[model samples]
Target: MSSDLQGDGGPDRPHAQTEGPAPGAAPTPPARRRRNSYRSLTSRLLSADAWVDTALWRAGRTIGEGMRSYDRFLRRFEVRGFSRAAAELGSDGATFGLLGLLVLLTFAQPAFEATRNADWMTTEDFAVTFLDRFGKEVGRRGIVLNDTVPLEEIPDVLVKATLATEDRRFFEHFGIDIFGTSRAMVENLRARTVVQGGSSLTQQLAKNLFLSNERTLERKVKEAFLALWLEANLSKRQILKLYLDRAYMGGGVFGVTAASEFYFRKNVRELSLAESAMLAGLYKAPTKYAPHINLPAARARANEVLTNMVQSGFMTEGQVIGARRNPAIAVDRSQDQAPDFFLDWAFDEVKKLSRRNPALARDRIVTVRTTLDPALQRQAEQSVDSVLTEFGQARRTREAALVAMVPDGSVRAMVGGRDYGKSQFNRAVDALRQPGSSFKPFVYITAFLNGYSLASVVPDAPVSIGNWSPRNYSRGYAGPITLKEALTRSINTVPVRLSIAVGRPAIIATAYKMGITHELQNTVSLPLGASDVSVIDMTASYAAFANGGLKATPYAILEVRNSAGQILYDRSRNEPEPERILPADKVGELNDILINAVENGTGRRAMVDGVAVAGKTGTTSAYRDAWFVGYTGNFVSAVWFGNDDFSPTDRVTGGTLPALAWQKLMAYAHAGIELTPMPGVDPARLKPAQVARTGDGTPAATQPRILSTRTAEVLGRIGRSLDALGQTASAGEGVAQP
Candidate 1:
């Protein structure tokens, strides 16, 4: 380095460096000078900070001025438009005011309050009629009611599922949710339709409680106001309870309890998760989502609700999936059988009871436990159906009715027509057609009461009363026939002679005593069923024989109960000491004869397997009506066949059609019951004429005869006419009138 320096003449150049500082030589400076230079540079940078702050301040001021100017311009424009809008709005203000007044007045009615309370009377409940619980009558319909339940009694699954399905934010939101409403509005606007509803449960309750189903802005506004008011005034539980109680489910169900019973045939508290989901889904569209209408669609909607429940944290995923796999539940529709007629009959009686005691006519649900055995009614219907069907096939007879009752006046079953749905007219209680030869039983009963015995011989030849000549159904008379044969064969002339001897008035009185309330003509032909009477009256009259001469007024309802489970009335026992109209011995004689009529008389076709049936057959003039009234030891039944329009039909007799119906009915009625033998008449009390001829050498007069005087006379006349034509009377006897 020293040699390089020597070569570069560094030592010698020291003097030159010192002289003027060589071209590349460094200059030496004082420390204070360096510090001063650094301070000056810092000062310049610090000064530049002021300019930056000033420029920013001026820019912000300019932006502020521009914003003020824009705001002033907007205010001026808005003021002008608002003033014109105010003028236009002022013109329509009075119209809106009047509309508001009208709306307020309309909604202010007391009926609105009553509707909100769900208070309205039904026509049948308010009617004035003394109807037997079993008797068919007018202005009667079944009961429908609104059932309320406690909040806790409502299933938790239903609540959670309903919220999940209908409105998930029900718990957190007020009566109206702005966010949900906004979303609904935007969705509606985008679709250009009203496909979604944003109503809360409160709003729904408001609509159901106080408004008709009218869609309008004013109605919506009122609904909203009411909903808000409800939200503030009532707790969430109360609102939900009201909704559940008052909401209308389809199929005549008006509340959750009723809906639960209607759909599941179970209590609301018994609903499972899947059932709860289905009921929840019904809230959106009850008719559409009803399980009865569309089970698959209802299940799909229910599954969606279950999924929503899981998503909304109301139910777990596992629970929801389990609910989805559950089977669909439904009520047993069979239980809702032909209750309309029974309920109609029951309500009519309830009205009468209520009329007797107006205090019982309160606005409460009443349960009427009736004497009607559904099974018996069904049997009666089937029996009539089978008879009518068979008769229609065999004899072209398409009309018939049947009434069955206990001898104690309890109506067991009734069939008013071939099809109750097609025609609800109850012919059993209303039709008053002639009873024909069935009336002869009452005549004979009168004769027996007047001391005529079963063996008493009566003239069966042609008989004349003034201008009227009575002939036997069989033209040729079996002269001097026993009274038993006269009734058994339903002979016309013999009954005429018996009626003449006993007096028609006595026959009429006997009919009245046996529960024949209808008026009977005091004519010679009345004993031959010339009087018109209802099937019910005739059946009841016949029942007196079965009940040992005690007359029971036909009644239907056994008891009536209110919604609160109070027994308003009950008919568990007989009303009082029954009205006794005939002596025991007389009734016994008639019953024996009637039983003989079924065993070997015109009503022989009415016999059933292992059953002892007593009955009489009747065929009206011109074959307008056919009737059979009968009874077992435990039950009595009546059947009638006729045209409703009162037109003539082919010669159809009670023995042919009505007796068959009675047989079919008794066959079913006594299906499992043991057959008990009817108590026969006491021989010790029998008179000489009342003794029947046995195979042993007894008197021929004592033998039972099946032909009446009129029928025997008519048969003899035909036989005589045929004899003139070279045909014997014996060959024509079998060709007597039915």
Candidate 2:
């Protein structure tokens, strides 16, 4: 009322026009002057008529009066009053009343343009779809979870709480409540916001079940007519049940029972008073009152609902106080069991694939082949289970996430969190965490590409740049260490010194080339992993090194064939071969250092039998997070462990949980496969030589790493670039270290 937030709901605002005066208020004109004018006009007319024909007019008036009296006398026997009208309808008046109301509403509702499809009148039968990846069913989607509870089965307190909070005069009124509407109007006027919906529960049900939510006069009028029709056709209990079953409860949830289970993990009948009130509060705005999203806001809304219930006489004041004091505990249902972490990740890709290809929709059942290897998925799951089971009790807050991809950028497995039901957030792809020392490889690799070497004597002593002094993770530094030794020890000051030497832009560019898509802050501490990134990118970047410097975009879907056996999409057919993003021989030097890191340094925990591998361990400041990124001949994997709330763990390091999990999973992934040397590395030169039964080993497990003939040419060019580095002056120019 103060401001027109309530104006026609035109693309600009969200309210309706001002409500008109109460029905039957303006019948005639203002009193005194209007009455005098009417009498003067009548008198003037009569005076003029008197001169024309007095005798003829008098005779016609007499006949007219006699006819009028006869007509009035005859009409006395017809149905004229409410009592007579009811008696005339015979028996079963409610039935006839309902029939009349339906007919009226059918005509009236359309005048307001608020009609619904026939299907809305009944329940919907939802369909389910499962996406298969690598001969395994990976994910399920599109199943509607709606179950109706009968009014009799619903708890009495819940019913009272709902009516009191939503519409107290539900049973008292025929369909609309004038007093409630008046109260809402006054409150809305006072608050200067649409603080209350002046609609009854029946009106709410009608709108929710069939109508659009555009606030306009026509919509309101249609809603009222539909409410009347519903009231006339269905019992009050039936209407209430329908409302409870169809209400939207946030996050694609619908209905009381489903919402009850979703929020509290309880049945409707078992809900406590405070729980019922909280649910009633959610009806106004589910997103605003979702306890899981914001507990305090939800509690405040529940208190307001309790006040309404007490004011409406549904509960006593004492009862309201007691309910507030003994509020029910909410469930911590953050994740689910079925889909796990990676399934949700892949399913998202499937949905996009479903949209792009027309044939995917032609069948009721669509078959999608993702790059996920079922064996690796199980290994990842088992690894997470193994580490958590062994170390979880002591540090119960810490949860683990893992992602594995082949050198060609095909994701084989991913575990987002400890439990998907408790939380669906994908930490591997969505979470942004400081990479810490895990990011050092990009700096070393950049330095190597810029003519530095694994044996480059990098200054590791503590130093200050202006007012900022960077320290190692152990708060101590080793002096004049080789770049490989610096990385192997996970030295923070050395990487920082190396970052400043190579230039932060060069380091950032190096990371970008290796598939880091997140924005990296151009700061001195960037080499110490001050910038945040997802695990998937880190894993994919390492895949570039595994595949001998080729740029690989990480992907999931392998093939999508419709039920008709017709091809819709195939990765090999649709996508072009990957291009190299780094020099092959230079990457070979970086790879040697990383492989040594795994075999002899901080990542020693990540080593497995029968293969030479490479990885790094990263422990952030204050033990906030831990990460381990490693790769083998066939696959690259990144693992992380931390609290979801970003709280510091109990001295957890990347070497402790993450490295061990990676070792177990990777060892299992290559159980029966022949040991093959990583690309860009000499098998005989690597520690404990990698020899495979197949003379021409497969670097991608099933596919060749250097597939295209053009890729071999690119490698040939990289080999020539390394040969030129020894003669160039750029190799001897030493940058000033901090």
For 195-252, candidate 1 gives per-residue lDDT tens digits of 6678877888888866666787667777776777678877887777777766666543
Supply the global lDDT for candidate 2: 0.75
TM-score of each: 0.51, 0.55
What 10-residue stretch in candidate 1 is worst by lDDT? 694-703
| Tens digit of per-residue lDDT, candidate 2, span 1-738 | 445553454433324424543355554446866898999999999988886688778889999999999999978876768867686676567788889778766756563343444434443322223343424455433323334456787877788888988899999987888899999999999999998889999999888866777888667777888888788878898788888877777543567777777788898879888898888888888877777766788888888888988888878999789888877567764443344466556656766666566556434344565666565676687778778888876975468889998788888788888755345578888899998889989998898888899888988897777788987767886788998888888887777777777799999998898899999999777888889999999999999889999998888776665555455777768878898789988888888888888878888777766677798888888788899999988779999999888898888888878888888777666655555588767888444533222211222132222223234335534764675675464556684433
RMSD in order of candidates: 34.7, 25.2
